[model samples]
Target chain A: MELNIYHLYPEHLNLYGDLGNVNCLKRRCLERGIEVNVVNFTDDEKPDLNDGDIFFIGGGSDRAQQLVYKDFLQYKDVLKELIEEGRAVLAVCGGYQLLGTSFIDKQGNNIPGLSILDYESKYTGDKRIIGNIIIETTLNLEPNKLVGFENHGARTYSKYQPLGNVLVGRGNNDDDMKEGIVYKNYIGTYLHGPVLPKNPHLADHLILQALRNKYGDVESLEPLDDEIENKAYEKFIKLYGK
Target chain B: MVNVRSMIALYAGKFSKQVLKLINSSGTALPGKLALRIDNNFLDNIEEKCDTVIMVTGTNGKTTTNNLLNHVIGTRTDKILSNLKGANMIQGIATTYVNNTKDHYDYGIFEVDEGTLRSVTRYVKPDYILVSNFFRDQLDRFGEIDNLVEDVYTTIEKLPESTLILNVDDPLVNKFTQLPNKIIKFGLDLDLDEVQNSSLSMKNCPLCEGKLQYSSHVYGHFGNYECDKCGFKRPNPDFVVSNLEEKASSQMITIDYGDEELVFEYPYTGIYNAYNVLGVFTVCKQLGLSDDEIVSAMGDFSFHLGRMEEMEYKGKIIKVILTKNPIGLTQVINMISNDERSKTVVHILNDNPADGEDISWIWDAYTICEREETVLHYYCSGIRAEDIALKKKYDNVPLDKIKINDNFKEIIDTAIEDDVEIVYVLPTYTAVFETRDYIENVVKSN
Candidate 1:
């Protein structure tokens, strides 16, 4: 099987080891006898939605987000169509913010988002809610935990349902127990320890979703021995999770 | 005239230093903290005493560059005060000044943290502000690189008289030249391929937000860059490394400063260190130091702990490389990959406030996964050892090759069990100190 992943605004919006998400998706797919091709669309380059199976967007600095925001408007319609078609997408941190209706900057100016998802984020304070985060998630009728790091100043409010409930750390906002959003096949989260490598299950889940989108019935993946991965995940949960 | 509160602060700081030493504490920041608490105007008073103050800051190489400045400038005169003790924040810088204000030093060379540059420079008007380079570092604590640049820019705006020595190769650092100040730019003129690796942070122009066209990447974001959109380009360096040839353990370079070109052999291993040499050379030339004097001072300088310093443990050679960010870690990995010896790699990752609790950067240092053939085994140890281990695992190092443990001794023991001749220990800020101490007392105990 072949999966084409579009990495949006990689040059500007790629911050905090965000490219690792692309690496995780590629390596995991390659390991499972799937050819994964990653195409980087930066600045004003529009992504071909038909060619894309999984769309990954990572976090960035505030300035980077502004730069990406300008170019984001040009491709919002295509992105909306991709979301409506139930194309598998994972947007993290700044990418998560950009998937929403609007994001307010430090100066309280609202930067328009794709609005494909019912969410809005605002830079409420100078303080950022940062630390190790553990979220209890139920995607595909399987209850599991996702562990990663959150480093963002904006507090997001979602009208649509979130990806998970907060298990250990601050989620979308300090007031809410909910974490990321799961609109159709789209997933948006503040988890950016690149969010995928540490949570192989999630990486596999996204891959499974992409495969299912393409071929309809997707069976369980040939389980690679996740002894070390489990060890790392278990350790993080034990250390940082409640 | 010095106020009574300033006098109290001075005496209290002096007394605290004495008491701290009696308790065997390094007291890098305690005295300064106490002194500042006594009188908020303590640093301002100390600044009045020092004739010339130089502030050095950036994401990496602050310590090395500051020490180089201290060596080059201090050897020329005895009346010099420097924070050679690795206390870089406001408290630590204040401690250096509070303790030495009475001595009335002619020069003060203090390394300021990028986040603390604005706060520190508010009082001490430096004669020279030397920025080494900037990268995505300590993201949790320092927030973002743009925020750090804003802080340093604000500080520079207040001090237009201060001579700004910047690394022009860094687009972020080069942007500071836009400010009206007496600026001297220092950069590596060698081929970008010679020094640059796969890891890069700033790929877009800060001004135009356009994709940066790199003629060469010296290391990190330091390179000859041009943005066709905004026409923002790399400035011609005032003091430049016209040529660089890497030897076994040193670098031979011809430094061009306008009409005067001096070819010298620099005793540094990494290409990043070559940039450090160029920065120091620029500072020395700006200070009116003779070429012979500057070369002699730099040549006599040696490694200052935990930065590519090697140690012997039993029959194995353990090279301790301090890696805090992706840029620094990538350089160390590149240097180690050049070695053909069968070696065990130990990576210590701590999420302590000092090491920037956000462990996402480990993934960006993808080069760690590049030289898999040379590495025999990977011993991942620290508070966040599992994170590093997971990163390595995903990078395709087989699960069997990685041993995740918090204990340094056991990790080292396992690495040497297979008669590994070399063990490369790459550690973060706090982990490096702990590893150094562990090697001193346990691993290499006579």
Candidate 2:
């Protein structure tokens, strides 16, 4: 079995350790004896999204977001079509803001987003909502509490299917207690402790969904030992799990 | 001359300083904060009685370089004042002056925090301002690197009288142009022959946003480079390192200054320390101190705890290296990877407020590679121990070689279990002091 991972704007939008998603997926696949290929789209390369089973996007600085915006506008439609065809994606922080309708930047500019989902973010808060964040997720996975860190100045509003409800830390906005948005297999989130390494179930879920996209009607993945991962997850749960 | 408000503020601040010292506390910022609270313009009298004042600012190496210069200056004159304990913000700087204002000071040397540079410079006029190289540090507290650079540019550009001692290697620090202030640049000329991992992959020129072309790559966006479109290029540094050899206990740095070749022997061995040494060396030379005197002062000095502190435990060398940000972490990894001694590395990552609550910066750094020859087991220990353990696994380290234990004592004992020559304990800000104290206890007990 093989999986193709498409990474967007690796140079510009590679902030906040978002590569942990790519690493988690690749490790899980390799542990199961599956071949994996990671294809990166830099600012100079023209992206072809068809062959990719899973797409990943990470956060960047405001200046970096502005630089990646030009490419996001060019490929939003193709990516939307791919997501509709069950291509799994995990976008965090600045990448999450970019997938929405529009987002206010650090300099108070209300810049347009790719609008792949019906959501928007505004930079109105005097202080950035930042800290370790834990969420009681809406996903039907076992032990569905996801823990990570959130650091964003903008407040996002999404009425669509949310990835989770905020158990701790400010989520999508300072109000509403909503966290990330989920459309099919596509997850747009603000959790960036990379949001994967410690969340083994979420990482495996994304990997399983991507494998299903490539090889249709695949059975559940062969589980590996997640003792270290579970211990890491439990620490965050104990700290912020109330 | 006799403003009762300023007088009362000074006396109250001095009284608190004594009381705090009597209680055996190192709380350096409180008295200054109290003084500022009592009299809003308490720092307005900063340069009133000082002869030659110098301020140091950067992401890293500010405290070390300030203390290095202070040691060299102390050799010449006893009339000096400094924030030696590294409470280097506006409040701490105010406390230094409050505690030492009884007599006229010849040199009011200070290490100014990068965030509080504008606030400190507004009242205290410096004769020289030394800018060490800027790196990715505490992004949650200080916004973007470009924005911080702009903040520094706007403040130092106005100080036309002060000499700006800058590091020419960092394209970010050297690109500040059209300033009326006298500029002296110091840079490294030799290659380390190891991994040329630039933590920042910024390909564009910092000044014109044009494409920057590098002739030689050192560490992070620090290299000899030129902008192809804007014609901006690396300046010829006033003080240049022609050669540097890292010894067991010391490093011999040879600086090529015109016709004279001066060798400075630093008692420590970190590549970043070479930059710090040069920043202070350039300042001392400009202050008319001879080359030999500067070299002797730097060689005889001792570093504060947790900055690559070496200890012996059961006939094994344990180095306690304090790493705060991504650049520092990458450098520590790079150093351990380059060492030929059989060793173990214990990485302690903490996400406390002091360590910057966001642990995502760890992803920005390059991982260890091809160090299996001398490298042994890796232990990840701290509040966020498993996070770094996951990082190691993702870095392609075999899972069997990586161990995760949040307990410091247990990990340290396990690391020293082997017949390894050295064990390097790399800890984040919050874990550094505890790790150092534990090692001190272990060494004392043994």
lDDT of 1 by residue, B1-446 (tens): 85999889878988999998999877688989989999887889657777888888888888888888888887788788889866898899878866774457778888899988888877888999899888888888877778788778887999999999999988989999999999999988876574443337477788876778888767677778898689899989998898888775678889987798889886777888887888888888888899999888888787656776777777777778889988888888777776777788889888888888888888778545455676778889888887888888766677778888987767866765657778888889887776777776655555
TM-score for chain A as predicted in candidate 2: 0.96
- Cα lDDT of model 2 by residue, A96-144, tens digit: 9998899877676788988887899987846878788999889988788
All candidates: DockQ: 0.68, 0.57
Q: Candidate 1: which stretches are off by over 4 Å?
A: A44-47, A140-143, B194-201, B369-373, B413-421
| lDDT value, residue B128 of candidate 2 | 95
lDDT by residue (tens digit), candidate 2, B194-296: 4543236566677664777888867777778899889888888988988888876678999977788987688887688888888888999999999889888
Off by over 4 Å in 2: B1-3, B17-24, B191-199, B367-370, B373-376, B398-403, B409-419
Q: By DockQ, who's the top model here?
A: 1
Kindly report which residue pairs in candidate 2 clash with one another: none
**Cα error, candidate 1, residue A24 (Å):** 1.2
The whole-model C-alpha lDDT of candidate 1 against the native structure comes to 0.82
